[model samples]
Target: MITITEKEFKQLSEYIKINYGIHLKIEKMALVTGRLHNVLIQAGFKNFTDYYNYVVSDKTGEAVTTLMDKITTNHTFFMREANHFYYFKDNVLPYLTSTVKDKDLRIWCAASSTGEEPYTLAMILDEYFGMNKIWWDTKVLATDISEKVLEIAKNAVYSNERIASLPAHWRAKYFNKINNENSVLIDKIRNEVIYRKFNLMEEVFPFRKTFHTIFCRNVMIYFDNETKIRLVNKLYDHMEYGGYLFIGHSESLNRETTRFKYVMPSVYQKI
Candidate 1:
């Protein structure tokens, strides 16, 4: 495996941080080496600097997309953080239904790693709206930086182990069992989420409609404080007045710097 010199690593690190908002700390050096070893080999790069040059010079985004897929961990599962779902189902849903008079519920899973979180939200919305779902636009906008994971998300297939995190009823109702080891989500549920390749670090949030709920869980862990604060504020601009923000349980907002009202651990409200 090719090794990166300090200078080459710095070049790659700065490029990623500037474009993707990932803070690759010194401890991550070994991870970068291991994760990207095969990429370097397959690209036929003799040295890290050469690989870095090629990645930057590649006009097509495929190079960077591959870089993100390898370096950025997309570790998520259905209902991985169950408590946030409970809060969304019990509290957020009720509030959104009662107040969002147009029934156009705009929800964004800003870090939809492989679609579990957005799909879970879609199922909950289906249950919450039930027969009246036909009257509402509950389509969820799910985005991730890596096109690779977005493809996986669009596939809508999961192993039995990955599917096991969902409720038993969800397993029966929303999925078509493929056999003992895999299942595919029913079209009714699968069609509810729209997947996109989006970078949160983009200066402007592009959607014309502000979201009523944003589930940007776990992804911010890779960002530094300044990046997180900037992204949080940008997200704030794209949310409705009474919108809810659900982050990872391990993450918290800086009360001093953010505009979101504290609701609970990993949950905040835009007042």
Candidate 2:
């Protein structure tokens, strides 16, 4: 088995931090080694230095893409953080429905890992609007840095165990049973989410209209304080006035530095 040396780990971790804003601590060395082991071996790299070199020097960008895929953890389930969804439905959706005069409602799932979060939002939107959904545009924008997860999310298939936490009514209404073990999101819900490959560290967000709601949960734990603040401010700029931002329950914005008013634990609003 190959192992990453201290120097190689530092260099590679710094590269990831600088380019992707994902801060890796000294303790994550073993995790870095474990995740990248197969990629290095398959690419014929004998040491972490060689793998790091290949990742930086490759002009096609696929090397770094693969690096990101392995390094980032995409561990999420349907309704992983249940309270945020409840608040979104109870408070945020009502505000949006009342104020969005144009009838076009926008929501962005900035850290959409596989598909569950965005699909859940889509289902809620469909149910909220019900028959009136025909007259309104309510597509959810889902994006992630990892193409591997994006492809899986786009497929919209989940194993029975993966979806066991979702409400039973939702399972029956929004998914078609693929088998005893797997189910696929129905086209009605699937069509309501648009998935894209996006990196939050990108200097400019490519969007024509600001979103009414943005769910950027869980992913910020990988970033250091400065990176997190920068990302939070960036998200602020891309939001419509009175828009809601739902972050992970574990994450908090610096009270003084952020413009978003705290609405509740892990929930903020642009006012």
Candidate 3:
């Protein structure tokens, strides 16, 4: 493993926090070593300080994006948290039907990686409500910082092991295999999600309308406390009043300034 000195870690932390509002914890050395060692080796750097210096000097954002992509955790799968989807289908969907005219429903999968989360959101919404076939508007905005992952997300292919996280019925209905190595999303579900690259550290969101819900699960654990607060506030702005925010099960918003009332553990409603 490539050992990063304490000083180098702090420098990298400050740089990432300043540029991306992401906090690299001390324990994430494994992540740093696993993901970024190649960047160092390719650059012929013997230590992380050299890599850090190279990154700092490159103002074009490619290196920065690469760094964030490496340091951030992106492990996720379809239906990773079943209850959140259940709550959305049973509770949130009904609310949207009454409140939205033209049957419009928009959801933002803010940390969307490799498409599973947003695609899963689409499947759950369409399966129960049959919205995929409807003429009225309904779509998922899926965004991630990594262009590499976003490309895979745009393709919407997965392995059986990846789709194994999905419900049996959804797995049967929404996915089809091309070969032993991969599966593809059904056209119905794939057409409903829009993928793009987004950086949470940016001051403005590209969305033109507030979303009914935002699934930002498991993404914020990479950020510092202050960064978390700022991100929650920004997400609150993009959410319709009374819309929902579903975070990772392990993450909490106890100190956040966003006016979201706790709906349950790891779930909050914009107020």
Per-residue C-alpha lDDT of model 3 across residues 23-117, encoded as one tens digit per residue: 77778666677788888888788998888888888889788778877777678877788899889988988887787776678889988988888
The candidate with the higher TM-score, 2 or 3, is 2
| Tens-digit per-residue lDDT, 94-144, candidate 2 | 998899999999899999999999999998888888999998999999999
Model 2, stretches more than 4 Å misplaced?
none
TM-score of 1: 0.98
Q: Write the residue-wise lDDT of candidate 1 on 87-193 in tens digits.
A: 89999989999999999999999999888999999999999889999999999999999989999999999998998878899999999989889899999999999
Evaluate candidate 2 by giving its C-alpha RMSD to the native, one decimal: 0.9
Number of backbone collisions per candidate: 0, 0, 0
The whole-model C-alpha lDDT of candidate 3 against the native structure comes to 0.83
TM-score of each: 0.98, 0.98, 0.91
Question: lDDT per prediction?
Answer: 0.92, 0.93, 0.83
| Cα misplacement distance, residue 35 of candidate 3 (Å) | 3.2
Name the runs in model 3 displaced over 4 angstroms: 27-31, 131-133, 255-258
Candidate 3: count of backbone clashes, pairs at least 3 residues apart or interchain: 0
C-alpha RMSD by candidate, in order: 0.8, 0.9, 2.2
TM-score attained by model 3: 0.91
